[model samples]
Target: DLDLSGTVGAMLRSTGGTSAPIFGFGIVDTATDVKVTLNDTNAFMVKGSVTEADLGFDNFRFGIDDNAPRMIFEDFGGTTWQLDSNGNNFRFFQAGSVKMQLASDGDLSLENNNLDNVGVIFLKQQASADADVPAYGQIWTKTATPNQLWFTPDGGVDTQLDHTGAFPTTWSDTGITGAELETLSDTSDADSLHSHSNHGASHGNTLDEAYDEGGAGAGRTITVDDGSPIELIAAGPTTKVIDILQSGGGFPELQLRPDGILFGPGGGTPQDISLTRSGNNVLALGASDKLTLDKIGATTGDVLAVQSTLKLAKPLVLDKGTSANIDGNDEISIPVVTWLYLTSAGATDNLDGIGAGTEGQVVFLTVVAGKDITLVHNGTVTAGKKLMINGEATVTLDQDHDFAIAIYDATATVWNVLVPGSGGGVGNHNILDGSVHQDSVADGVTAGSVIIGNDTPKWDELVISIPGANILNVLGIANGETVPSWKSVLDGTNPAATAATASPGTSLISAHRDHVHPIGVGTTRGDILIWNSTPVASRLVAKTAGAYVGGDGTDVVSTIPKRTIVLTAAGGKEATTAGCAAAAVVEAGTNDVDYWVLDFDKDTDEFAFWNIVMPGNYDGGTITFRVYWTAASGSGTVVWNLKGRSYADSAAIDQAYTDVGETSTDTLITAGDVHISPESAVVTLNGSPAGGEYVQIKVNRDISEDTLTADARLLAIEIEYTTDAISDAI
Candidate 1:
């Protein structure tokens, strides 16, 4: 080995030829084996005594291929050092260190960087596929547009997802607004799962806060928004339902079942409810169970009531009307809550048994007028055996009408009359007899004061122990005693009393004593007894004299004034004609049929009669009448044939018409002595008409006699007469 201290450089050139030196530093003997090695300076150092430099052996090197350096090492024993393969690749390995590797394809890697299996932090290339790349944990798209950090799952592909909304690492649509997302930054970790500095107060998995029973976290609620549907699916049959349980007690408040939901009072067994979807998706209840809808706050013992008024569209009738006659044997059946009105057309009817019915069945019976309806149950008034009233069945409602309202009880089988007793009477006290009574007065009688009889008696009787004032007994007259007269009870006038058996005086001087006489004179019988100033005592008087001297001392001398009786055509009369058939008389008739007598068929219109009487002491006189017996202006040739007659029986006198006068057919009777003569002989008058004389002045209208205009009406009648009697003959 040779060593150089200074720069002594010499180059030995090789001869130009095909043969050249194989190495710069080489062993000449090619067959000899050589070894070159590097060692530390402490052992392989050369130390010289004459002016030598310190030698430090640090790095080694080698060259290949045209004398280019192949591998090199630098800075031995320093912090900054490196081993370079000089544009080649190399690898280093140990059991538990980071594997430093290099590939022949010019790629480098450090294996096992304290990450999970196949999970890596990688960088993707821009615009090219990253083949066989790690896809888990953190990644960088540094060479791509808008540089971003990507978190991918294992075996990541270009399955892109956006996390700008709702949740990070979750799928979301692009262009989402911020309001749709939860803030997940460290400044405001308002999301379901986030991390912050306050680890003690913060939830690790903020989306779920679990709690045990009786713990602080119990009763905490997790609310799901409507935008998200919560679905709890069982992994297998082992986990089938979701239960909402009562806090602390562990009782299930509600259980969502695969079939239905059960929710109610939650003690032993929460109300079991199930919905069954049958064919056609119909929901049906289980057999033997009813859907009971109850009012709120209703107790188990209370009855269910309707919330509003209940009106029935039809009448609630009980048992149908009995078609069969009501016999006393068969019991009639009835239903509850109805009116059973049974009308019996039979002459008589009786009620026996009322058939079975529910409680509150009303049965009404209506009986026609004059019907006999008797209740014959005759049961005593017991709890369930009696009807309306005890023994009321014995009362026969046979009078006129009867009606009853009865109710029935199913258990009792009895018809109890709600409205008892029958009404309808004429209210006749005579028929009521002793059945009716009233509170009595002081006496034993039930009505009226003791001192009086009937309030307004039709006939009254007076019984007296002593006669009252102004009362006299005519039977008390003795043999020689005088009898009291009307003057005894009157004031300012007294008549001389006469014996009870005194006969009428024969002489006029003696008869004038107790009789009323006229002031001037009287000579006829039936002369009215009146107060006379000349002879004071009661006196006999002649009627003509009494009437002439009137009691007022005025000379009335004329007879009774004639009274014209105007009888309308409707006055009472017997006519041979059924109805009047005259033209002129019909025009003047009160009604169409009320003309006095019509002469259409003269035999049919023969006679019209009036039975009347005149006052006594009246001499026979002429009788005038309304006569429609002749033409209004005519001669005797065309006369209305009618006659007038006055009769006082057979033994007395009668005036008769013997001629048919010329002017007999006046419509309005105006003539005085135009005689409508009877068809007999004429007579003259002598004496006054007597008492007890009923004269019938009749008109005989004979339309058969003459044909002019005999349709006559006797509208009125007038009697003109005079009084004739001896003035002083009494």
Candidate 2:
């Protein structure tokens, strides 16, 4: 590899000899920094140089052996300068027509120079790998003039021009002219102009002159000769005749003049001819000559005349020689003719053999029996054709009649009349006899009453007269009950033997049976009427009178009555305490009575009373009590209490002693060995407790003032009761 780092300027020269000096430079150390210079003093290198004393070499060659020869200047610090393979400065020189050259497989473009002096130049090369080639497969060329660079084919076959002339040499010659064409022609006679046939002038005639000359001898001309004969004849006695000879069995030819006249074959002579026109063109014919016999009776002389009469045997035949007489009878008679008569004839007349009547006389001709008479009138009958009747002749319809008359409208088409009556006017009444009815009687009839049997007249059957009676009253009485009355016979009888009485009272009332009576006033009361009256005065009075009343004044009590009771003591003494008191008691022989009278404010009274008494502490004392009550009927004892008390002494009661004495004093209340105890002393007063003096008494009673009570007490008293006789004897 070559590594170029610095610039160097140097020159090397080769001296000339017969062998032509050659100079070659090679890179010794490709890795060194070296730059070959052209001259030492110039500071730039030339590839090869010339010295002062010798002619230097004209060409120099340089090369390097490194893989990349361009690496020699890759690191040079200064501006880049291009170098050759030996690292020598590149140069150019030209001497006369020879020049130093450089070439490459790619483009060689010169910069900044107009290359003018060279006459012609060319470049040849194969296309590179990257080049685009056109479809025509051209080769690249570099020429100096005209197209500077182009591609062309290698051969002389230029496909761009016409190939009429000789190719290759002629194509390459730029100065060739038309005279070269004659030299290329052939000179042999067989190849000259006369050798080919002249087809252009072979058939020389034109189409118009050919057809004109060919048509000259064809048959379309007319000629006449001097020896043609002429004859004159007339169509009638005054007509003219001429003969026309037709050759070749065709119609004779005639020519028309420019003056609008026609001439026949005899030229300018008068001929027996007739003038007729076919379409708009006129034609002339010879009068006596028959061109064709269309029918057998047609002759050459049978031409028509002006006033001649033609008579046929029957109607259209000629020369049959039959005779007919139209005589004075105003009838044309022919022999044994079967004629159809179109007029009506009477029923008895024969139409076939009728005698002739006087002229203008009306005659009747009869037709055979059972044939219809057809009357044909040419003109309308003005007053209408009437079959006039004389005397009493009538036109009666024997069976069913079918009278059909044809009527017409404005367009004259006939229509039949179908009305039931006689058809009136034209077209107005097409319905003939349409309103006539065959049966003209009325539909039904009515008569008077129809009766079945006869009966004797009775009073009920006789019509009776009542004052101010109408048909409604009669109908009411007819449906009424028939009752006998006392005025008839034995019940106030009528002298008439068979009499039925009309009872006034039992008879049917007019208002009851009559429909004309007002409904509510006369008829049986309906449910609605009875229902309307039921809740009024009658029901009101019943409801009010029967309704319950409260108690009366006399049956009520004014005040509640009260009963009073007055308490009375047995000794006629009163207790100091008004209410119940413990000290109150009854005396020994007296009794206390509590009045318990019952008082009732109403009619009845009730009373209930109870009392309880407690005994005192009196040993052996007896007390007696009794309770009694008085009621309205009687009095009865209710309860009793008795008690007795024995004291220690009777005088102890009066003495002012501290203690009651025993023994002679007989102290009922004693205190023997008087021992006082601490606890309560309980003296159970059971049955009747004994009475005692100076006794501790406790009475318990659960009783109100209104309740009964008993007296119980303990007391010290002397027994002093004695009978009357015993006290006397003592």
Candidate 3:
């Protein structure tokens, strides 16, 4: 070797005592690019040279124990970072007594910490300058004393929250004082300064004294500034006054006027207010006035009165004696009583049980049972109550036992009955005198004439009965003469008969001329009756052909006939033949086949028909059987195909018929198509089978390649047409 190298290693010795090696050097993996250098100025410097590109980047690591890297510094893809791992593969770790970690899987864990164990995790806030924030901010602590908590403010004194007793120990609010509290508590002295105090001018006062200083029982006057004077009740002043003092402490007394006159406290003159009158039976308003009463008249000053009798239109009748008031001028009947007592008396009717009367007022007493009755005034019977007959005193009803009239004497308060002989023997039954209530018929005169009354008796009409005599004969009417009996006419067999001028007798035969009345004879089915010109009588005539007979009155019978033509199908008139292909079998390879064809006949097709029946059936899958119709002269055509499975029900068959040109294996017709069975499908061309025109109906079958059978068959087609011409057919 031509080159010469001197030092393989260099070292610096420490100048101070007890100092370890200040400079050192080491190499790893026999690579000089990867090494650690130590010097006095710099701490340990571990690095990899740029030449070590295979290491991806550079990594400086420190470790312990097996020297496994506990912390690593790396530069990868231009991003340099440090990674540290705890022995448990945790990315973050705390080296405290109780280990805590953030695992590589992003799980944060603390040893001996869980929900069931000590769940206290203090979350604290850093100090802030804001006054609203506490110096220590929020602290969550689960291990605090029961019902007791600590609270601290940033710039305030600490407080203890104690929930040890009933709600509010003390409360404070604006505008509230201890006096207000006393008012709220019932245990407080009721007479305290706060008790029911007037709230000054700010609120309102309940006392009328206008000030709070008024003493109890102090007198005060309320003066109302209203303009009107106060009004006092005109009557019952003592009872109506408001005594505004304690227990008869008494209000101001009012003075009375000795002369029954009242004056105001400061009045100008005296006024009379007395309410008493001095008359014995009168009411006078003035001090020097007098009222007098007499019988039914009263006189006071210029006043005068007159007495007149008042009478009721219908007097009440009492059959038995009873307590009841009688209306003034109204009568009460004591019916045939031997003894009668009149009760409480009055001056007017229906007032009391007694009859109303003034002095000299009269009432009547009657004995309806034809017996004498003694009447007594149960009220006040006196000498003035005596009845006088011929101006003599009497005590009983009149001997005639009819009625007695009496007058009341107000002076003695008695009724004086008039005796029978006193007033012409109580004229209950008066003789026929012109004076009053006299019959027109003479007194004591007896006759067979009916008597009428008018205050007098007279004859009105006389009725006489005769035996076994005719009315006309009784009237002495001669033959050929008529009597006026217009109001007395009678029909057959009436008891009371009335005569008529022209038809007096009952027989109608006498009033008509003789004539022969020939009755009608028996009629045949179609026979009509007509008038005969010569005999002038009705005779039956045979009805003409095509004519019907009916009644047109007694002898006017007529008839009209109609020709009924019924259309019946003519035998052998309509012809049908096979339609479609020459044979029923559709060979396997045939995709479509023409099966049935109907050739129409002009003679029968020109008229209406019932149907064109085509007998056919099918056997295949997805086979289409089509029916085509040609118009008369083959000018137009209509094609329709059937649908459904071979074993489809009637509804499916009907749907198939309606769904024209439909592709299906079976169910190829309408109800009228007459699908008797899967083997027999009779297509009935309902009445609309191209009637009145020459039509050719053809049936086609289109079968798929996979169809079990390649064709459909149509047997004979018969046209069921009516023989009747279209003009007369429906």
**What TM-scores do the predictions have?**
0.18, 0.10, 0.15
Ten residues in sequence with the least summed lDDT for candidate 3: 615-624
Q: What is the lDDT of every predicted structure here?
A: 0.38, 0.25, 0.32
Ranking by lDDT: 1, 3, 2
Q: Which candidate number has the best lDDT?
A: 1
For model 3, residues 1-730, the per-residue Cα lDDT tens digits are 1111232443344434525444423333333444343433233446665332232213453433244444545554433343345665654323323344676654455566554546664433323112335334322222332322333344322223332321123211112222222223222222111112112232222233322223442223332334432222223432212212222222322234222233222222322222223623333344444433221212222222223343334443433443332323233432123233332243212211123345555455543332333343232322223333333322333343445566666565545555443232234444443322222333443353233332223422222223232221122223453431112222223232222222344532121223343344555775544554434434566555323446555534445421221212221122233223232222223455433323333212111122222212111112212222222121211222232222222222222333222322333343113221122132333122322322223233333211211122232322222221213222
Q: How are the candidates ranked when ordered by TM-score, highest leading?
A: 1, 3, 2
Residue 80 local lDDT, model 2: 34
Off by over 4 Å in 3: 1-537, 540-547, 551-557, 561-607, 610-730
Candidate 1: 10-residue stretch with minimal lDDT: 196-205
Report the lDDT tens digits of candidate 2 across residue range 552-659.
Answer: 453221221211112222212211223222223332233543222211111111121121222222223222222221212211111111122223434232222232
**Candidate 1 — which residues are off by over 4 angstroms?**
1-330, 343-346, 356-363, 367-372, 377-386, 390-402, 408-414, 418-730
Scored by lDDT, model 3 comes in at 0.32
lDDT accuracy of residue 177 in candidate 2? 23
